[model samples]
Target: MRLARFRHDGRVRTGVVEGDHVLPFEGDPGMLEIIDGSAEQRTAGPVPLDDVKLMAPLQPRTLRDFVAFEEHVEGVRRSIDGSSGVPEAWYDAPTFYFTNPHRVYGPDDDIPFPARSVDRDFELEVAVIAGPEQSIFGYTILNDWSARDLQRREMQVSLGPAKGKDFASTLGPWIVTADELDPYHEEGFLDLWCTAQVNGVEVGRDLLSNMGWTFETLIAYAARDSRVMAGDVLGSGTVGNGGCLAELWGRNGKQDPPPLRDGDVVTLTVDGIGSLTNRVVTGPQTGDLPPVRRRDQAQARAERQH
Candidate 1:
């Protein structure tokens, strides 16, 4: 079953998507609750899909994004850090980072470009929403918008992808229940093709099977010594051979194609799930916010002596 959270007649409602219409439920029993088997799939009336405004399928309790694609890692490292190979530890374990859940964007929403970014890029990925008994409730498309310039500068500190990645992440259109994808499951991996398009032009494509680490493995790693509760979201990072402008430039040595600009429509599609489309719009200028600065260790020691 495909489920969606939307606003109709100025009130937010949750519903199961049936074709182009949604079978609305009476109360707002959050998507997570429905996934946990606490809420029933009862319907009230059908609402036309075009009449309602879509929202993120659910408000995630926590968001964890993992780097599970080797090609993506290699391409990024070679492009940004001049490295020809991945880190040795990456082979032994899945690595991930927590992102701001408050900045989530739903399908058809306009994503504002971060003020500090000149090189904005989109990461095409798939994400799983956790349900009861450590099982997956549903799947959705995830677009991890990145400010590559900010990310590069911050990584120099060896601590974070912080402000660089916390700006915005896009999810939804709707969630496709695990049962809907059972046909595609084989040997613990779902065989689905994921694609990304910029303004209707195909830019990247890859199969979910290309991922080096499975979603189950990534979730297990995340749950170690930590509670993986309902509503927690785990992203399957960028797919193998997915193209961001940086990776394209690194591979082809062509920089003529510009980075994401205002009015660019990015669409990510995963075969079994659905397509998530978002537009890029310029945001309000950053006023009075200082640019990032490097801390001088020598100057700090001299000040401590005083």
Candidate 2:
């Protein structure tokens, strides 16, 4: 079953997506809101999916993204220096980040380009949204929009990814339950094609099976020392050989990083997982953009940027 959170009338509630409509899951809030409820007992309201705005299915209590793919890790490192690869410890330890939940956006939203970013690029990934606590539910397409310039600057200072990666991280039109994609995790060849389209033009593409680490390993590592709540989200950093900018933009080492311009639409689509489409817009400004108003606007804005 595919799950989502959306707005109807004036309230924001969680729902399940079936075919062309959205089924309202009115119970508790967050992942637990739907995870804890039964689909058999769910009395759904049919809202034309086109009319309802989609939000991230789970309101992640703790959002942590891991670098499960060694190829991606190595590519990023190589881009930084002549030769940079994943350390032995990285294979042993599950590396993660505490991202701002406020930064997460829904499936069809438009990601905003921070004022600081000049070069904004996309990272195509398959993020695993945990089922109950430590269980690996299934995978969803992820677009980790990056500001190359800021990231490089911060890395130079050795206190990186702040502000650079904090701007936005996109996830899901629906959280594909593990059962649906069963054999992929265990038996048969779980081959799925993934691609990225910028304003209808293909910019990147990759295969789901190309990653170095499996989803099962990610789950075990994530739950190793700590407890992952029902609504928590874990992201698969990026995929092999596909770089929206690291290779395309030459790592911003040569010149100014390219920022996402207004009207640029980025679509990260996976075979069974569906497409995660978003537009790029400028963040809100002062004068009329108050602090509280900005944050509120950001949240609302995030819903559309996804």
Candidate 3:
């Protein structure tokens, strides 16, 4: 079953998608309740999908994203620091970073270009929402918007990516339940094709089965010292060879392409899951934010003090 959250008849609702229509729930059955098996699938009349505004299927309690693709990790490392070797720790265990849950966007929404970000890019990925008893409820598309310049600077501190990634994330068209994908499971990975498009041009493609670490393993690691609650989301980081300008530039010997510009539309699609598209728009201008310090300036200032 495909579950969707949308605005209909001047109110928001949760419903099951059928063909091109949504069978509206008789009551507001929260997504977590549905995942926990407490909510019934009773429905009212069908509402045409085109008639309602889609919303993020659910607001997750927390979000963890993992780098599970070896090729993607190697490519990213080579792109950023000119190294193709995988870290020993990465092979030892699944590693992930927590992101801001409050900054989620829905399919078809306009994503504002972050302030001070001149190298905005998009990451095409798939994510699983947790269900009761350590199970996966469903899968959905995730677009992890990044600010490359900011990311490169902050990661030098030995900390994880922060402000560059926390500003925005997009999910959904709808969630395809795990049971629906059971037939495609091979070994521990799903046999699904994922792709990304920029304004109608295809830029990247990869198979979901290419991930080195499975979603189950990633979830297990995440729940090791804590609880994984219903509505928690775990993202499979960028697919192998996913094209972000950072990777593309490195492949082309460091010449940059124009970063995401205002009015550009980005679409992420997974074979079984639906497509998620968002338009990039200019965000509020930076009013009085301080500029980041340059390395040269900092060194010169230290010499003067001595």
List ranges where model 3 is wrong by over 4 Å: 255-257, 289-306
> Per the 3 Å backbone cut-off, how many clashing residue pairs does candidate 1 have?
0
> Which lDDT tens digits does candidate 1 get at residues 1-306?
899999999998899999889998767777877877888777888889999999999889999999888888887776666677788988988999999999999999999977768888888989999887677888998988988888888888888789778989988989898899999987888899998889999888889988887788887888998878878999998886654666665565544356899899999999989899999987778877688788899999999999
What TM-score would each prediction reach against the true structure? Answer: 0.93, 0.81, 0.91
Tens-digit lDDT string for candidate 2 (1-306): 777777777778766678999877645255555554333336466788888778776666766777766766766665654356577987666677767777888876878777666667788877777767477666677777887767777777766577778888887877888777775543333467778777887766777776556766667777777777666777776765553657443443542334357888888888888998899887865243456533577788899999
The positional error of residue 159 in candidate 3, measured at the CA in angstroms, is: 1.0
Output the number of the TM-score-best candidate. Answer: 1
Instruction: Give RMSD to native, each candidate.
Output: 2.2, 10.2, 3.9
| lDDT score of residue 163 within candidate 1 | 77
Error of 2 at 107 (Å): 2.7
The Cα local distance difference test for each model comes to 0.85, 0.70, 0.85
List the candidates ranked by TM-score, beginning with the highest. Answer: 1, 3, 2
lDDT of 2 at 288: 37
CA shift of 216, model 2, Å: 2.0
Single out the weakest 10-residue window by summed lDDT for candidate 3: 249-258
